[model samples]
Target chain A: MSAVMAESCLTRNEWICGEYLRTRSEELTDATVEHVTITLVAIALALLVAFPLALLARRWRLAAGPILSLTTVLYTVPSLAMYALLLPVFGISVSVVVCGLVLYSLTILVRNIMTGLDSVPDEAREAARGMGYGCARLLFGVELPLALPSLMAGVRIATVSAVSLTTVGAIVDHGGLGNLIYTGMDSYFKAQVLTASVLCVLLAIAADVLLLGAQRLLTPWTRAGRRAGRRRTAGIPRDSVMDAPGTVV
Target chain B: MGVLPDTWTWLTTAEHWSGDGGVWARLSEHLYLTGVCLALACAIALPLAMWLGHGGGRRFGGALAINISNAGRAVPTFAVLVLLSLGPLGDHGDLPTIVALVLFAVPPLLTNAYVGLSEADKDVVEAARGMGMSRRQLLARVEVPLAFPLIMTGVRTAAVQVVATATLAALAAGGGLGRIITAGFATYDTAQVVAGAVVVAVLALLVEGVLALAQRLFDPGHHRRRALAAAPATAVPARTAP
Candidate 1:
């Protein structure tokens, strides 16, 4: 059975080597879209869980160690093992992929978010409390903005890795570039595999750059010094306060 | 409960532990792939990173090399494996899988080593130099020992990741515990898949635990307080903005 499959795949080498993408533009586009959707959804879901968890850890200092270690354990579970663990429960689909990717993102996301919040000036927090700002208002109006760079750094790491990780979901028939990769591997279709793999890599790089752009746009004070100069009075004496958050996590 | 008993049954079966695709075979294959890939990555990345860290003149160049290598993380190991197996590397044996895993391991190895050496205490380095030490002596006697903890942390991180990711070798027709999962999937055996996953997870944790112990035993600067501070950051690729 394996020999026959390899032989059949070998037969497609001519067109696969020459005009693979042109011949299969539709498949490529669909896979690309699926890849993007999986990545975006996973990061979004990770953020939703990570934000509150990070805040909880911040509010209760003792909770930080256990929570971070739990996420680290989650992060350490290999991606393939993670998928298998999820598959029995979630069934073979996008949910399994998303759940696993979100789990992987949590360690970085929570750590960065916590770090960001930790870097908030104690004086600033006291001032916010003195001004009668509630917890929610203080978090959103002051703490979150100051925390933007670290949070965005985490988001960038999560987003880029999630893009690459989406390819692993092909086993569960999630219909992404991974599908093309696995199919190409099974059938030995060189062009199909190369195209899909390259696109997966490119997608990860592109997602990273896009997130960097979003970070720059959202945190304009990092780029514009006047706003930074103003914030310096109320900010923690940290060096990265004025820099872009593109630091690799 | 159903899955656990079924997984135990699958694991306990003598046949499952023998043959070309048996548990023992797959476990050894997984280890071989991880061992070779990690060795190659260390060979290639360690010297280069050490040189860059020790030289310290072209800080920009060293940072660039580290960053470019780290970008390797963004490229999924699976994609790289598929590309190599189906493309120029040829869909043959474990060559492509080795190449892909090695590439995946390099970034962390390179980054941590570079950061560890370059970030060594300036006072210590200056004192070494003042004591009539050559550059090599300083690196060998002072900097490398000082930097050992972070360097080993990088190795631990890479080893665990490689062990986990090398499971993909089975997808590319290479050998590993992943074959069990892949074969299980082929046969529609969820129990087998669950068992395979359990084995892989256990293997990963075991390797991680062993490395953690090895690090503590060999680390020159193994203060409990510093270890506590460094543990979380080292566990992940923490390039938090300084």
Candidate 2:
């Protein structure tokens, strides 16, 4: 059954690729690059908007709850609906794509930033203030650096989610990896579909690993826990593994 | 009414609720699709998560499992639905749709379960073992129960995702609330779109509320009124001594 399916997909691809392999490959590569670039830009925009607002929200509980809740509500709206809503205002262009992706990233980003900032021990803040550091200086000098790990966690989640949602923009002729999936689906081209699907899955994995590596490089604190986790697992029995400290029970 | 002209007409239409089928029938089908997909996801992901969590010296394998799940998370549901439909799975009615939904749901469930179980308290596990509990007993009685809250968090996230993504099933000829939204979009019928959107949002909220209640029931500490009933007598004393 697997062989037959593979043969059928290959035959279908051969039929579609009659004389356009070069062109199609170029298109596919271009789509992948375009998707990545647009998604990164959206995430950057989200971080810019969300980080400050999240910090401000932390200081004032009144602002924090409503802002965070609003972002959560926005997050719940489906990507398709968000794109459709944007079309009227931004039209079928990069603007619509960017707006949709950025909005989606905000909820995760804001929540993470706020949580990270709040995670900074209160005593640290008091000490900074006692030393004559102003609020802005304290936030920039003390809070931000300590909050890096949590902030990166949010960024990682946002980036992956953005990459996934970028495919949806294909519905409006905004070319991306999703466009490849869409074309394959419309024409019932199995090989094209499979290739695109496999690439997407790989892209997600690669992006995640890269982000994880980046997290380790930037946040040294987590490295000890990760290393400890590794040592505890090495040569350990399955049952003994659970007894390792910091292993979630 | 004036502001939402499209939504106003849709709310008044017979087709919105009862042209070919009654409201109950339409809703039942939608709920059915959502329920089956979520259930299948839970069945697959729960065990997978448990195995990965318990599987030691296999951190690389665990990371691979998580990476696979993260990949699933990154693929848009509609794109997966399209891929499955165009592939060999197309021969099965709504099978592709269910498969895509399951794929979509699995990542969160598996990741959360593994993370939750792996994060289980070490002292608790030691205590259970010191008390002479077997590996199976430790897992079943202590680890799983303690991990329940985090597992529920994964389920909650997965549930919301499934509810929202199931709308794409309409594109694959599987009946769900998405059909209305898609149809509404094609014809520029804002009312139909509004009706569908409203129903889906309400359905999502309903599911969330039900799950929230379930979570509260499962979590003894969530119910403020039951605080006195659920707390162990030694907790306060233990904290005070420290």
lDDT of every model, 2 decimals:
0.79, 0.71
Clash tally, candidates in order: 0, 7
Prediction 2: B-chain TM-score: 0.85
User: B105-169, model 1: which lDDT tens digit per residue?
Assistant: 87777777876787789999999999999989999999999889778877888898788778877
Clashes of 2: 7
Candidate 1 lDDT by residue in tens digits, A19-50: 56656799889989988988888889999999
Off by over 4 Å in 1: A1-18, A225-249, B56-60, B223-242
Q: Model 2, range B1-242, lDDT digits (tens) per residue?
A: 33266676766767668754444566787788779988999999988788778755336546755565546656667667887777678888888888877778877787778877777888989999999999889889988987887788778777877877776676545667777766766776655655676677677667766887798788743565467657776544521100
Give the Å error, residue B215, model 2: 1.1
Q: Which window of ten consecutive residues has the lowest lDDT sum in model 1 chain B?
A: B233-242
Q: What is the interface RMSD of each candidate, in Å?
A: 4.8, 7.1
Indicate which candidate wins on DockQ.
1
Residue A17, candidate 2: C-alpha displacement in angstroms: 6.4
lDDT over C-alpha atoms for residue B70 of model 1: 39
